[model samples]
Target: MSFKNDALAYHSEGRPGKIEVTLSKPCHTQQDLSYAYTPGVAEPCREIAKDPAAAAAYTAKSNLVAVITDGTAVLGLGNIGPLASKPVMEGKGVLFKRFADVDVFDLELATTDADAFIRTVEALEPTFGGINLEDIAAPDCFYIENELKKRLNIPVFHDDQHGTAVISGAALLNACEIQGKSVSDIQVVFSGAGSAAVSCARHYIRLGVTPENILMCDSKGLIYKGRADISGTYKEEFAQSTQARSLADALQGADLFAGLSTGGIVSGDMVRTMNERPIIFAMANPDPEITYEEACAAAPDCIMATGRSDYPNQVNNVLGFPFIFRGALDVGASAINEEMKVAATMALADLAKTGDVPEMVLNAYGCSSMKFGRDYIIPKPLDPRVLVEESYYVARAAVDSGVATRTIDDWDAYRRSLEDLAEGIQ
Candidate 1:
């Protein structure tokens, strides 16, 4: 059967969709039903009414995240609308459960208006521990996320923006070490100026890349100072004073090229124009700006990565979000702040350097060995260590940053619990 047919059959065979609500507690007996629905439920409701924070203890709100989307930007499909994006949102729920044991309720909103989306999500804070905004378009995504984060007490994360940023930031840390370059000194150029690109540019700066040394470009050439085209957009923050007006122009002597735009836009010649040992993350999905084969043919010394799993150093967001959220939710974090993000990145980078890839992970990828190098710059998504290590670091950071309401009394016990959780899933 064709791949397309197999996918459709898989989703349709057992259930109508990818996800369903399963009972974590028993309700088989008539007495259990009363406890689950009416009289017994009223006790917890009164407790929560007296103290709103009691909801976490009495209900599943602490472990529940809403994977909500406006569906204006569904993967490489683009603007498929809410109903069409259900499958993708449900897939996200599957990952959240399979990876971190987190519960997700996928919510697809039919409206695109930023204010309406924010208002709806804000009103849902009582039902969810976190809000995962997905697949919304760029500028509105920026606005919606900012407004929701400000209005809601729980962690509100846009996986499209920060997930890629965190994962790629980890890869960048390892790549710089192997290439014998300094993070503060490297000249980084971006191929897209959308949410992911803007977020990555900011994240790289936080990771030590100089803001002035970075150049960002959109569909209409480079974003330079005094450019009227990007006056009121998120791209304005990246606009710099430069003579470079095109991607090719920006690539000359550049140490890194981070592509988040459409595929087939970057060529081999453009790769060659970059500095020796240049790190090229041509991460446009389905197809990259430049293929791994073409990039190697152009610059044999360069470290190449893409969004595709067929290539090495794939910057998959699955490596970041699940574990990051697990930590945030465990700590009862008020927000997914910058410190927690950096902690996750650092954990991933450190994991790659351990040179102790688990046997199961190696077998899953059909490889005998994997280590930190030009090829394996980030941990594979299947590696069980990510759940324990990354989540620990993020949780620790949340406590140290003073954003966590609940604190872990014993660090060793917390880590062991995470390991147990990982083992249960495996």
Candidate 2:
């Protein structure tokens, strides 16, 4: 059968969708039903009413995240609307459950107005431990997320922006080591100026890439100083004062190329124009700006990564979000702040260097061995170790950063609990 038919059949075979709510407590008996409903349930309600923080203890709110979207940018399929984006949202729920044992309720809002979306999500804070905003288009995405973060106490994360930043930041750390280059000294070029690309440029700066040394380009051309086209957009933050005015012009002597634009926009000649051992992440979905085969053919020594699974060093966001949220939720974090994000990136980079790829991870990917190198720059999404490593670091950072409402007294026990969650899936 064709791939599309197989996917449709898979989603439709047992159920019409990819996710469902399962009971955490049994209600088989009449007595159990009473406890689950009216009288017994009222006890927890009374306690929560008396102390609003008691909701975390008496309900599932501590473990629940709402995967909310307006569907303006559903994967590579742009602006498909809310109803058409249900499958992707449900699939996101599946990943949250399967990977970190986190419960997700996918909410697709039918409105495109940023204020309306923010208001709706802000009103939902009582129901969720975190808000994961997904697939919303940029500029508006930037506004919505900022407003939501300011208004909501719980962690509000836009996976499209920071997820790519965190994962790629880890890969950049490792790639810099292998190439013997300093991030602060490297010349970086970006092929897209949307949410992910702009966020990545910001994150790489936090990871030590100099802001002035970076060049960013959107669909028009290079985002240079005094570029009239990007006056009020998020791209304004990245506008540089440079003579380089095109993607190819930006690539000359560049040490790193990060592409979040459409496919086939980068060429072999562009790769050759970069400095020796250039690190390239052509991360457009379905197709990259430059294919892995073509990238290697252009610069044999270049460290390459993409958004595809078939290649080594795939910068999959799954490696970050599941574990990052697990940690944030575990600690009752008030926000997914910059400290926690930096901690997650450091954990992933450190994990790759440990060279302790589990046998199961290798078997899952049909490989005999894996280690930190030019090819293995980031931890695989299936490596299981990421759950404990990244989560632990993020939790620790949350507590240290003074954003956590709850604290873990015993670190070892907390790690074991995370390990149990990982083991459950494996």
Candidate 3:
């Protein structure tokens, strides 16, 4: 059956979409309404006026995240428009609640203009604890995030960018560890220089990737340092060393191929050009830049991954987002900086080592556990540790960095608390 038909049938059968919003606080009587609404609300407002930070203690703002998307880049079906992106947005909202006990209001932006997007989010910022920009396409995503951060004091994070970076970086760290390579010593080739690619490059560099070793490619070709192969405000930022006419050239002796591009962008023939045991993350949704089977056959020792569920290492952003924002907001983070992401990556990489997640998590990735080997260098999307142990690392990183407004002294206790939150909220 078709996905649309199945979704409609399922939703029709079971209310098909999201249900009614439940109150966090009780509102059983008239007195409750008076307190929740008219008279009781004023006291908290007055206190917030006296000390702005008090808002976190008294209101849901600290735990609330605005899941904003424009439907411009909604999954594999790109540019489906805002209304159509509702189900996906709502699903994201459910995840926030489930994984991190975060209260999210999924917002399908009415307009697509960069300036309008910025203004709209800025206007809404006062209501949310943090803003999670989801699936908005390139250059515009860049503009919106930069503008919103400038205007709002709350942490503004674009999940597609940072989330992808964090998970991918973690996977890369482990892959390199197993392969006996280092990011600084290798040449990294990235396919698709959109929001995901650029941010990944930026963050990877922040984690010790040298500028000379990174190469970017779009549909047109490689983003060489002086080469005018690709253009656009987005591509210009990380423009580097050599002009890559194709993925084959990009893979020529390249140590890594990080795909944020399209499915089938890289082929079996291209995989042969990489260094031995080349690490390839063909992370295009639904499929990938290169299929794992093909990459494996081409380079027998290759460690492969994708954005799909039926893969060895699925680099899903859900593994990063919930806890990432949890940690950032816990400390009243001013911004979602690169260091926090690196810390997140490190934690995720460690989780891959434990080999002790739910059975379903292993089943989803075609295996139960990958014990420090070629196939198990990354974590699965639903590996549980994402909202479990990882949040503690992120929260601790925030506290250490002094970005956390509300600090939790014990990481082990905090990690358990997150697991509890996930149990109730998710």
What TM-score fits each model? 0.99, 0.99, 0.92
Candidate 2: which stretches are off by over 4 Å?
Answer: none
After best superposition, candidate 1 residue 7: deviation in angstroms? 1.1
lDDT digits (tens) for residues 222-251 of candidate 1:
999999988977788899999999999999
Candidate 1 vs candidate 3: the lDDT winner is 1
Model 1: residue 32 alpha-carbon error in angstroms:
1.4
* Full ranking by lDDT: 1, 2, 3
| Residue runs of model 3 more than 4 Å from their true location after superposition | 1-3, 229-232, 358-370, 410-412, 422-426
Give lDDT tens digits, candidate 3, residues 66-182. Answer: 999999998888899899998888888877766777788888888889898888888897688889998887778888898888888888899989999999998888898888888
Model 1: lDDT to the true structure: 0.95
Candidate 2 lDDT by residue in tens digits, 1-426 = 999999999999976898888898999999999999988999999999999989999999999999999999999999999999999999999888888989999999999999999999999899999999999998899999999989999999999999999999999999999999999999999998899998899999999999999999999999998988788877888888999899999999999999998999999998999999999999999899999999999999999999999999999999989999999999999999999999999999999999679999899999999988988999999988899999999999999999999999999999998888788887
lDDT of each: 0.95, 0.94, 0.82
In candidate 2, where is summed lDDT lowest over 10 consecutive residues?
A: 227-236
Question: Alpha carbon lDDT of residue 114, candidate 3?
Answer: 89
Give the RMSD in angstroms, all C-alphas superposed, for model 2: 0.8
lDDT of 2: 0.94
